[model samples]
Target chain A: MRAIFPAYLLALIIALAPTSVLATDDVEGAYRLGGGYALGDTGLRLGGYASTEIDVPRTAPWHFSLSDLSLFLTWDNGSRLHFFSELEAGDLLSAGEDESLGVQNVHFEFERCYLDTLVNNNLTVRVGKFLSPIGQWNIIHAAPLVWTTSRPVATENLFSTHATGLMLHGSVNVAQHLLEYSVYGDASETFEAHRSNNPFENAFGAHVRYYLTDSLQLGATYANFVLNDLQPIRYNLAGLDLAWSYQRYELSSEIVYRTTHHTTVENTWQGFIQGVAPISQQWFVIGRYEYFGQTQADAGQIGLLGLAYRPLPPVILKLEYRLGEHNEVLAPDGLSASFAILF
Target chain B: MRLRLVYPMLLILCLAGFPAWAAEPLAVVTAPDYPLSSLSLDDLKLIYLRKSQMDAEGKRWIPLNLPATDPLRRDFSRALFSLLPEEQEEYWNIQYFNGISPPKVMASEEAILRFVASTNGAIGYVRKQKVDPRVKVLLLITPFPPN
Candidate 1:
């Protein structure tokens, strides 16, 4: 049943394409690179992105896998109401020298499914499951959108990535600057839990971002949640992030601290700063450093250097190497490469 | 000797003014009944970037664009955002992942004018000469001096 969900979605989207095209008087050009196909004047759109990765670690067998295949649908009523949903199929296939080439256990999950009603210019009410607006990276973490193939621990480990409930979000212009904010809460279990991710039973969070300049912005986040465990531990978290870009060079950083009420080791914290510089029109040099301190584990520090090339706007190729003092599973020392596309 | 000096000065003036003369003027246009008469450069930038969706009156805006390769689009982007369409790819990618698309693109300036004139809240850019009475010119943009 899980494996067939993606197929069913794809079929549905394809089936509607011709009908939508025929209904509209004017149809935009066939297919755009990153821009999805507009399902005519119906206010519906169909699109998705996929990524493949190869990993070579010193302590483990080298492997190649289809990391992500995601399909998203969006509907806008040409007014205040909007709907969006994304379904992802992960780890679809794998191959290695020691392991035979074959289909692997695929994980299917709904990344986001939400309805947004624009109450006014200053506020929007969103209901359903949506990405937790904890930091810049997590909200735009699609494979083709981010600079790095591997995510920083701080972005994922300290908090739940998705929340199921309600969110109020909007942007306002204060003076000459732009201030954007989101306040969300989840009082129920996650809609469809992915095995790899930690979901909260009850959680609430707020994120605020202020644009200091066109190229730079600062962000703050706070959240409190209860873990879905037998013991039901309660945790509180706070995070800060910064992003700045000028011409072809960019710099971004994020830091998060989490505290639990029930544990003797009360706190865990992590952070990373990343920079990207253009080497050529289609190539970029990327570098990053990360630090993580877990409650009952040795502190870990990692440094990474990478290169990315984009032959086209919607496609990217990346290669990177990671080295760290604590070469554990969370921060393994290895070389990795990926090819990703947004269509 | 005087003629030579005059010739050089005239040449310099023409060279300095070449960009404004060579580039076509653009009209930021919308339906004739659109609530606002004009838009600030900041608001225009936000609309094109998909950051600002509603106007001061709380009406949703339907921002439109030209094809990526169109010279008019290149000029519009350069004049408004100081960035080329290619340079905006990364930004659009992030928006796409978040389910916010870039503005819908029309095939030609004529189509843009027609759409903007007929549809409520629709706004687009076109050659100044191409705008007709049916549409309202919200703002007039002069081409930037070439780098």
Candidate 2:
């Protein structure tokens, strides 16, 4: 019942879109079907993105699914105040032949809803739920924008992907290099339903980024969180990320470590290095290797090879093959393909 | 015989047109009211790419662009971003997801200059020959990237 509200809101907005569709004449630029329309002279804009995936594994049954359908609404009250909201329905449809027959895996929920205000030129304050600015992937994980059909297991499982509450962020220039930082805290369990994806109850985190050059960036993040369950377990995490690009060649990597104390202390780490190159105007080749380890379980590594073609910037066609050692049952070696579009 | 004749003809045409093509220069322009009269190439890149928002005075700086199909616009994008069209598109896709849009686009160089001249924070670029006294020249370079 909690999910019904977002579904209705999405339907209502989409239904009301056509009336202002004709008034969006002056917003002349590339027209993408998935791109939202500017609502006349108002500051409101609406857009959405969706993706479908097909996975074929060696031992398990092939799965075909509509993975994600999400809509975003942003309202800017001039330069001072901004509002952003996202509603997502994941695993909306799945082939019911075998594995998915009795799986109740569908979810409709609010992903992000935040209000941001510029306190000054160098500082901004945000209130509400948002993607944790821990690393690059967590913020920009939309399928159409990401290169691979599947996400790195390390990235998905290492940290809390979203948080609810207050965040303060700013950037300053120091010695010709831009330094950016964000500190956030989720003190109260106010929006429990909206923040179900957040694994922690009380959390505080900070991230800092350094832009050494136009082509190079380095960042570090730290967070302390408490599990919301009966016996609130305490945990501490640290992460480092790097991005570098030169012309058509690009490289990015991220590594994160976590430690938790309940009865005793345990430490775990995960990381991945990804490289991408454009072979032609429309084609890009990508490769990535990832490692995941824990004190209790055996360490594992996975490698992926993929290629993507973009007929248009808003549309992407991706195919990848995965090979792994250590956890084949959880993340099987398989061929995955997906077509995604952002409008 | 046909091949030999076409080769020399092509070479002659290339030799004759090279100097004329290379002579055109690009002029980066901002409003006269803007404090700084000149900018480094890196500064220009930051403004055009929407990575930087304010001028030295703390007032907002608005970047203007020409229509994508215009040759002058193509030249500016290729030279400044150092990216192919597809790569540029990919870059903008990411930007859009992050809630930023491309710079405002004008219809012609005259419109660009007129806008820049009237708007205090406006910035745009065009062929050097088309520049007028209305707008201040921030930077100038050959239309083609330096080889």
Candidate 3:
């Protein structure tokens, strides 16, 4: 029932698009006639990006894996009303036997849909489903927006990826430095979109970042999680992050510590120093060496040394060798190739 | 006898040193009134290659780059990156993943000169001979100069 609703709504939008474009004066930056035939303007913005990658495991035979193909639709009806959304379908062309009784699995899943009010650009609150403001990666988290399509291992596991709830965020300039802050409260029943049946827990988190210069930043965040899943567990976590980048070289790191059972202090650290050089205008070379380790525990160690080329601003291709120690079972050593673009 | 002979050779080597590496034309100039000044090896890397967004006097500053294949561009790259053939790749790839775009490239010294001259708040490097009245020279760096 839920899957059919968006399809019907998308159909409705398609039918109404002609009327919207016929009523517009001209095609501009964010608003234009779809295929030069629709009357669309005054409040709609359309943009989308896609990515695909193939990996060869250390021991298994080579195979093709398609991870992502997505579309974005957003609207900002001037000041107080807005909507942003994405529909993504991943892992389309994998060679595997179907496990589920009878489903081809080709449907668009809504990753984000939110309505925001702009209280003067700098301060505002949003309600709906959106990327969590818990850590750095979640804010500019799209694949094309980031240098590497895959995020740091720590970024994937520790930070909350998305949430359904309310978030209050604001920014200010203090003594010439820019500072941005966010606080969010989410209901645990809305965990992982697909697994949202239980409704007995709630979580809250806050993050603050200070931009020191055009190429450097300092940020810190603290979050406490409480759950009521039969046996409740409470976690107190804090993190400190710093980054410096210039030209084709950059250095960055993050440290996260959490306390559980009221006294045990466990910490994990991740960082990397990388450099990018242009071999030619059409062909640029990239190299990176990164490491993240856990203290007092064998937090999995992952390092990627790779190179990439850009055919144009909208297209990028790369080859990388990824090696992980400590998690021998997950990913031993592998070579991967990927392509991504946004339009 | 040996000391006297070695003395002239040492003096000659010093004189031939940097000027040979970075010789400048006698009367070349540049363009673009102000976005950049007193550019060092570090500043060049930060401004041009990094594509860093900066604000000065309410004017947005943008740095441009020469074509990767241009000779003068090779000289500028050597001076700025200071890396051998193998290290430059690793040097730049690290920055790519850091969410920074490399500088946009133009065809020639004339293209660079024309671009900096026409665009507001633009900065670039070119040959001293190519410098003209259309732009402003912010810094003068050469292998050697008459002191």
Candidate 4:
């Protein structure tokens, strides 16, 4: 299996590395060797994050994978301009799949690499490939950062997750309320599909967000693009996302609808609501419910329950169970647990 | 007789554990030449989180923090952010993923004080006792009981 080699390598590294590297003094910062370190006072930084996961579905065997290994290169410039770049190797190694599933031995990609120019306190310009600022999860989808092992279907299925072009983003305070917006357009297929996760081409999108306070946020997104899967199809999608958090509890939800310009195909709408409550400083529980509706297809509902534990700041352990109705063929009921880390 | 003596000694130990302690106040200070003389709690929170980069005057603002485990830093974060250690960790992880890093961390209050006092537009927090006239106090956070 593809996961065999990476499993051995990971085991060997863990066995050989010094435990003192994770000493108390160095734990806040990344482990000294693989940690995020500033390059002197030059404003440049080097850091990386990696995560491996294991999953078991009702219909499939246990799946073990080296999910993501990424490196970050950033420059603050200490001025109005900044540079950020990320190189990712996803599905770097998988223990349970063949080449037919698009799971390669070492799949390298440029997840996001961009340049940002701040015009002022209220306006900025960004150029290059960046994550599409759609739903909340689209921007913070890293495994270790999210609470559960499974991502909501709407976050991925409704629109392209990445855009390659220029964007204008800004935020301003209006009567003590924060108003934020971003507009982006793609002139051509700038990113190679194989080297990047570019699902669409010739796209234009806009996102507007209003923050009543630090705890609450509401946003809307709209995009039009030509799908890149096999035959090119024109599609328009719109979404709304909401997030609110109190001391120990948080709620997030997103709704998306998409349709093709040509009228024969069915339009689809999907949404999911998820809540998380911290049981203690190191542990939390989560519940999520989701629904999808199609014009001429069977509608479906899904429910998930999850528990997460953080042994350290950069490490997370998660266990999740899912139940689905009317979408059993697409997403089988399953239980998955994973260990993820960020550094 | 042995049991009675033991009970008296235990009572003495319990009394010793409940001594009254004074809560330390924290001063958020900036360089003498810095534009602002005082700041709101909202502005302070935004600055320390690296969400805002400039003062109202459009001048750059550099925020500094003490090492994570420092008692003073812990107290300041608790009173201001109302976040636990694990929550703080999660917050930092999200920021890192979004291309933002936490403020520069100094080893001790003296280092933070020195940095803020010497650098223009720099800000840091220290115990009220450590604050000197070299830096301007922008805000004072009254200590809350540690959780």
RMSD of each: 4.0, 5.8, 10.6, 8.7
Report the TM-score of chain B alone for all candidates: 0.85, 0.82, 0.65, 0.84
Clash totals in order: 0, 2, 24, 2
Ranking by lDDT, best first? 1, 4, 2, 3
- Model 4, residue B13: distance off in Å is 16
Descending-TM-score candidate ranking: 1, 2, 4, 3
Estimate, for each residue in B49-96, the C-alpha lDDT of model 2 and write its tens digit.
Answer: 766666767555667877777778888877886654445776777766
DockQ-superior candidate, 1 or 2: 1
**True-vs-predicted CA distance for residue B82, candidate 2, Å:** 2.3
lDDT of 3 at B30: 35
lDDT of 1 by residue, B1-147 (tens): 899899999999998876455676899999898889999988899999988888877777888888778888888999998988888988898888878988877878888887777777788998988888989999999878667
Report the C-alpha lDDT of model 3 over A34-130, residue by residue, as the tens digit: 1111124344445556677766767665545455666666553222444566667765545422233222444455566555554543555776566
For model 4, the stretches where C-alpha displacement exceeds 4 angstroms are A1-35, A97-103, A191-195, A294-297, A328-330, B1-24, B84-86, B145-147
Ten residues in sequence with the least summed lDDT for candidate 1 chain A: A18-27
Specify the highest-lDDT model's number: 1
Residue-level lDDT of model 1, residues A168-246, one tens digit each, is 9999988789999999998556444443267777899999999999899999999999875456778998999999999
Q: Model 4 chain A: which ten-residue window has the lowest total lDDT?
A: A18-27
Task: Compute each candidate's TM-score over C-alphas.
Answer: 0.90, 0.83, 0.58, 0.83
Give each prediction's DockQ, rounded to 2 decimals. Answer: 0.53, 0.23, 0.03, 0.24
lDDT of 1 at A112: 80
List candidate 2 stretches off by more than 4 Å.
Answer: A1-30, A33-35, A99-104, A191-193, B1-17, B20-25, B34-38, B56-58, B118-120
Question: lDDT tens string, model 4, A1-343?
Answer: 1111223433443344332111111123433322377665555577778887777887777777878999887666356666777789888877764324345667777777777777766677887778888878998998888889888878886567887778998777777877788999864465444434536678898888888887899999898888766567888889999999998699999998988976666688999999999899889999999898754458778899999997777788999998988766545589888878777
Between prediction 1 and prediction 4, which has the larger TM-score?
Answer: 1
Clashes of 4: 2
